[model samples]
Target: MARVYISIGSNIDREHYVTAALDALAGWFDEPLISSVYESESVGFDGSPFYNLVVGVDTDLSVAELSARFKQLEADNGRRRDVPKFSPRTLDLDILTYDLEVGRVDGVELPRGEILKNAFVLLPLAEIAPTAVHPVCGECYQVLWQAYDRDQKLWPVDFTWQGRRISQASAR
Candidate 1:
């Protein structure tokens, strides 16, 4: 089985969609290693803030299959194809990394470019996989997070799933 990390975000009905995402992921792949949910200003567009997090799951499915599954799940949760790329979303899911694979695999890019560029992606990834080395950068996630210089705005928010508290808002 390959360990895959997925980034999830929702700006429309944040709490509902995020919970739905976790539920679906758990149902499909097993219990996941989830990161702290973060509330962040939308990037590349002026829209509502988004709740973002990363989830790590083990699956034998190929990259193409995983991407297809995630897209279908997003569609089921009210994701629209008619909107702009960065428009407000009910759900957005992207495969961040698939094991140690790098470059393109099954038509999807491994070690997604946004990992280093988006705080939303990097921070949550670092939280869950601090010791996992980036396939391309040859550095651990914790180190990359420490060196990250992006100016994006994001913060942890109190979140609960399956009757358990998973993330708590920081004293900011």
Candidate 2:
């Protein structure tokens, strides 16, 4: 089985879609290693804030199959393909890493570039897989997060799944 990490986000009906994604993931992949949900300003476009998190799962399915599953899940949740890439989304899921495999495989890039460019991706990834090394950087996630210098901001939000509080919002 390959240890895979996926980044999930939703800007529309944040709680509903986030929870639904979690439910689907649990149902399909059993219990996953989930990171705290974060609220972040939309990066590429003007829109509502997004709830983002990372999920780790071990699967034997090939990368293409896995990507297809995630895309189908998004489509089921009302993802609109007609919208611009930076537009608001009901559900957005992207494969971040598949074990240590580097470069493109099965037409999907391994260790997605967003991991290093976005705080939303890196922070949760560090939280869940701190010791997991980046395929190209050769550094663990926690260290990368510590060294991250971008101004991209994100904060944990109160979130629950399956009757359990899985994330705590910062006290403001």
Candidate 3:
């Protein structure tokens, strides 16, 4: 199984949508490593702030399969692809890193969009997956994340879903 990391965020009914997505992900992957929820100001959009988090899941599914499932989760929670890029969303789940494998889909690379450029994805990612090196950049998340002078808008929240709990043995 490959260990994949995903960045998830939402600006509409964020807490509810994020929790539901987490629950859905647990049904698909092996044990997941969840990060704390962070509220951050919208980056490329002019709308409400967003709640963001990163999750690391060990899965037998291929990257394309996982991405498809994530998109489906977004659609199930009312995400609309027809809208402008960076538009406010009900749920946004992006694959940040998938083990050390890197390749392309539809001629565009994996981690295809600008999801990693935004600190909202990097901050919580650093918090949880600090030592995981960037597959493309070869830099640790903490070093890369802290080097950027991103606005300190992301704040932590205390909401988490059950059932996908990190195991005690795995926690060690």
| Candidate 2: worst-modelled 10 consecutive residues by lDDT | 163-172
- Give the Å error, residue 20, model 2: 0.9
- Clash-forming residue pairs, model 2: none
Per-model CA lDDT versus the true structure: 0.95, 0.95, 0.77
Ordered by TM-score, highest first, the candidates read: 2, 1, 3
Q: Any runs in candidate 3 off by more than 4 Å, and if so which?
A: 105-108, 112-116, 163-172
Scored by lDDT, model 1 comes in at: 0.95
Q: Candidate 3 residues 1-172, lDDT tens each? A: 7877888889999878988888898777767788878777898778999988888888887777877888789999999999999799999988877777677753326653453577778877788888888787888889988787855566676574675332121211
lDDT tens digits by residue: candidate 2, 1-172 = 9999999999999999999999999988967999999999999998999999999999998999999999999999999999789999999999999999999999998879999999999999999999999999899999999999999878999999999988999975
Error of 3 at 62 (Å): 0.8
Clashing pairs in 3: none
- Taking all chains together, the TM-score of candidate 3 against the true structure is 0.86
- Deviating ranges (above 4 Å) for candidate 2: none
Q: Score candidate 2 by TM-score against the native.
A: 0.98
Report the C-alpha lDDT of model 1 over 33-119, residue by residue, as the tens digit.
Answer: 999999999999999999999999999999999999999999999999998898999999999999999988998888999999999
